[model samples]
Every structure is written in structure tokens, then in C-alpha cells.
Target: MTLEQLKIGQRCKVKKVLAQGMLKRKLLEMGITPGAEILFRKVAPLGDPIQISLRGYELSIRKVDAKNISVEIID
Candidate 1:
């Protein structure tokens, strides 16, 4: 599933990011790479920026950006 589809409190393992070109490179630069663990924290009031826990911290990403990231559900 895609990161944008994860519900609040759900945990997932990063599979890969489908974005290409500069967009994909940018995401990788932000520490979003394969094999990372991610937890959905909360969604913005408007549901645009979704807060997620990653690498021992929280980072908010827009829905569009999250869509580029795919993940495997974790128990």
C-alpha cells in the first residue's frame, strides 16, 4: 500500500518510492528510502499534510508526496 493510504497509528515498513526524476531524488534526500519504518501519527485538519513518525522523529508530508511512497503493513 501507499503511505497516503495508511491510517493513523498504523505502522509499516518502507518498500520503495515510486516517484521519479528530481522528485524521487528529493524524497531520498529527505531520508525516505527503502527499508525504513514509518508510523502514521496524524493527519492535518484539511488532510493535506500527514504527520508520520520516522527515524526517531516526526515529519509531516503532503498527500501527494506520500503517494509516491509504498509500504508493507506491519503487525
Candidate 2:
């Protein structure tokens, strides 16, 4: 499933990132990569930007961007 599909507090591992161009590069630079583990942390009431824990850091990403990330539930 996509990262955007993750519910709050769910943990998952990155499978593949489907984004392209600069956005893809930025996501990679933010430490989101294949095999990386992620924990869904929080989301706005409106559900746009979502917070996640990755590589021991908290990262906030847009729901649009999250959609490009494929993940598999871990726990």
C-alpha cells in the first residue's frame, strides 16, 4: 500500500518510491529509501501533511507526496 494509506501509529517499511524528478530526489534526500522503516505519527485534522518517524527523525510530508511512496505494513 501507499504511505498515504497508512493509519496513524502504524509501522511500515519502504518498498518503492514512485515519485519522479525533483520531488523524488528531495524525498530521497529526506532519508526515505527502499527498506527504510517508518512509523506513522500524526496527521492534520484536514489530513494534508502527515508526520512520520524515519531513521530516528520526525519527518512531515504532504499527502500528495506520500502517495508516491509504497510501503508494506510491519506491525
Candidate 3:
């Protein structure tokens, strides 16, 4: 499934990142890579930005950007 589809409090591992160019580079710089674990923290009230915990810190990403990430839910 895609990162945007993960439910709140869910844990998943990044499977792949479909973004390209600068966005892709930025995500990589932010430590979002294949096999990285991600936790769905919360979403903005308007549901535009999604908050997640990864690599010991929190990062908020736009829904548009989140869609570029593919993840597999972890049991």
C-alpha cells in the first residue's frame, strides 16, 4: 500500500519511493529510504499534512508527497 493509506498509529516499512528529482533527493536526505520504519503519528485537521515518526524524529509531509512513498504495514 501507499504511505498515505496507512492508518494512524500504524507502523510500516518503506518499500519504495516513487518521487523523482529534487523531491526524491530531499526525501533521501531526510532518511526516508527503502526498509526504513515509519510510524503514523497524526494528520492535520484538514488532512493535508501527515505527521509521522521515523529514525527517532518526527516529520510532517504533505499528502501529495506522502503518495510518492510506498509502504508495507508491519504486523
Q: By lDDT, who's the top model here?
A: 3
lDDT of 1 by residue, 6-72 (tens): 8899999989999999889988877889999999999999868999998898898999989999999
lDDT of 2 by residue, 1-75 (tens): 999899999999999989999999998999999999999999988868999999999999999989999999996
- Residue 14 miss distance in model 1 (angstroms): 0.7
TM-score of each: 0.92, 0.95, 0.97
Candidate 2 vs 3: which has more lDDT: 3
The positional error of residue 49 in candidate 3, measured at the CA in angstroms, is 0.4
Against the reference, the lDDT scores of all candidates come to: 0.91, 0.93, 0.95
The reply for model 2, stretches above 4 Å from the true place, is none
| Candidate 3 lDDT, 1-75, residue by residue in tens | 889898999999999999999999999899999999999999999977999999999999998999999999999
lDDT of 3 at 37: 98
Clashing pairs for predicted structure model 3, backbone only: none
Following a full C-alpha superposition, what root-mean-square deviation does model 1 have from the true structure?
A: 0.9
